[model samples]
Target: SVLEGGTWAAGRRAAAERRPGGGPPLTILSDGTVF
Candidate 1:
């Protein structure tokens, strides 16, 4: 299922805060996929 807008927005905000420089702010090191 897709994530809700509020949840996704919050995640983006958290990611931005976590990586303010913003090259690739978020990374999910799975087999070969990321959101």
Candidate 2:
């Protein structure tokens, strides 16, 4: 589950980077939690 979450987060980050004019900032906690 941890690996899957990491993969999903990475994919999301990649997609966000592809957005035009930049994407909103992401807040990730030290525990791997994102908001």
C-alpha TM-score for every candidate? 0.48, 0.54
lDDT tens per residue, model 2, 1-35: 99998998887676555455454444333324344
Q: Tell me, what's the RMSD of every candidate?
A: 5.7, 6.1
Estimate, for each residue in 1-35, the C-alpha lDDT of model 1 and write its tens digit: 35676777776666555454543523522212244
Q: Largest TM-score belongs to which candidate? A: 2
The Cα local distance difference test for each model comes to 0.49, 0.57
**What's the TM for model 2?**
0.54
Question: How many clashes show up per model?
Answer: 0, 0
